[model samples]
Target: MITPTITSLLNAKAFESLVQSRRSVRKFDRSVSVPEEAIHRSLQCALLSPNSSNMQLWHFTWVKSPEVRARMVPLCLGQNAAKTASHLVVFQTRIDLWRRHARWNLEQTPPSSGSESDKRRMQLMRKYYSVLMPLAYRTDPFGLNTLVRKLGSFLLGLTRPVMRLGGRGWQRVLLHKSCGLAAQTFMLAMQAEGYDTCPMEGFDAVRVKKLLGLPAGSEICMIVAVGKGTPAGVYGDRKRLPLEDVVSIV
Candidate 1:
């Protein structure tokens, strides 16, 4: 076990303040351009966010060109966030790259020295990437993989707890969940860097994909507009349910 140090405690307080200061600012100060370094550093922080199985199926598209930003504004339904932002970041999930990532993870495993525990660990790592990952991500035209997953889950769950697996919908949800976590980390990092962000789900994903030239298996998670926020950008006082109302103790 580890104990929190004074520095860690202070950092926690700072993090709380940062979270409190963050807001979904719809209007940005166009006159004040966001530093390129800030966006770059924030994206780097986002890349370190926790993801399922470390597959890292996410991608970020930074729209800095004025022409592309202009094209994306209408794609985002002409939202003020897109219209005024100095930069727009598109978060995407590329489920199509799963196999490549899995193979990469396998390749990253180091060779074991002469030890039973080390050898067993290496074997488990290899099997996890080679066998389990393929089973989890593979699909077919006739829905055969989905059928097998459902049947296996039902049979195993009858005797012990098992993860219920499904078709493309489930896979998409898994990738999006990981991508959303990365997006949150990016927003927090931006806030720490004295910037504001608005995550917009209101957009024509089809058109945005075409504009960005994203492949078929790529899905847009959200479009985040970033810049210096104006006072008028915040809609109103932040509202949330009371802690007791939302939390439950067993």
Candidate 2:
């Protein structure tokens, strides 16, 4: 087993501070520049985020070209965050690569040790990526696959709990959930690197997709603008519902 470092054990307060200090910075200091290494490290940390079934049906596009960045500003509705930021990272979901990813996962299964238990475990892992993944992701122009999944779920759930499956809409939601987790991780990592970010959802999706040349099966989750934030970027003090109102212990 891996050993935990002393830094990890004593970093709880540091982590809390990091979370508290992070803000949705709307304006960036144009004179200040963020290092390329900071963005590289933050993206690396984002890759380690938890995802559904380890399929990793996500992609990050770092817009470093000045030409593209200028074009993206209007696409992002001419937001100040996009206009003044040093970098813009686009988070996207690639549901069309499910088959390739599933096969890759199956290939990663360890070879059996000839023991019955090991053999069975390998068999299950193989089936999970090969058979079950297809069952979850496959779609057709007609609604036949969706109908079959609904019927199967209903019949199986009568006796035991089963996952409710749907068509493309459900698949998109699942991928977006995973992509959102990565985006949060990226933002936190950027904060740790002494930078600021603004996750912007106010964008023309169709035009952005066309500009980025994204495939039809791919969907943008969010675009995060990163830079050295100005003091005025923080609009006001943070506000939220009291813990008693928002939290429940059962």
Candidate 3:
């Protein structure tokens, strides 16, 4: 593999700077509007974020119109970020669409000649999407599937290392994790594009889902506000514990 050149190292430093500079802005300058194209570009970058099993079970809802944006202010609990921001994006996780996404992953595998290695790879992909994913994602009202998964994990782990799979709650956690990463990517991309973003988790999920016309099974991970942030938007100086306190070499 090719090693990172000096140019690449410099680019890495630039990315570090970008990461360090980002703040959870609360107040945006209403006079400074964020362009639609910038939001689109940042979302494009967000689409490239790593996700579990490449299922990509997430949705980005950009609240664009003035009327809808007005409604969102109250839905977001009347936060200054929502009230003054130029763009609002709702991150949603669709755990109910697992089967469809698994099938989509299956269709992405190219047809290969029946060589041993090729056949093995193809079969592995098929089994993962068709069998394992169904086992992992399929839920029951009475928690029967959860019990089966726990039993299977216990039995498998008794002999060798095996994943401890749980029920719908675990699946939701995994999906939300990936969705949060996408949101982070989008926020950084916006920062790089000379805009600011605030990720708001304090909101009425029930009302937001209804307002967005989302299905009952869908979950709102977070709502991000975007705009040219004002000086007062930053609550205080950036603060973090010492690196040694937060991290340790193991």
Q: In candidate 3, where is summed lDDT lowest over 10 consecutive residues? A: 209-218
> Local distance difference test, per candidate?
0.95, 0.94, 0.94
Per-prediction TM-score = 0.97, 0.95, 0.96
Local accuracy of candidate 1 as per-residue lDDT tens digits, 9-75: 9999999999999999999999999999999999999999999899999899999998999999999
**Candidate ordering by TM-score (highest first):** 1, 3, 2
In candidate 2, stretches whose alpha carbon ends up further than 4 angstroms from where it belongs are 1-9
Q: At residue 59, what lDDT does model 1 achieve?
A: 94
Q: Which stretches of candidate 1 lie over 4 Å from their true place?
A: none
lDDT of 3 by residue, 185-232 (tens): 999999999999999998999999988799886899999999999999
Shift of residue 65 alpha carbon in model 2, Å? 0.7
> By lDDT, is 1 or 3 better?
1
Model 2: per-residue lDDT, tens digit, 100-133? 9999998898888999999999989988998889
Cα error, residue 234 of model 2, in Å, equals 1.1
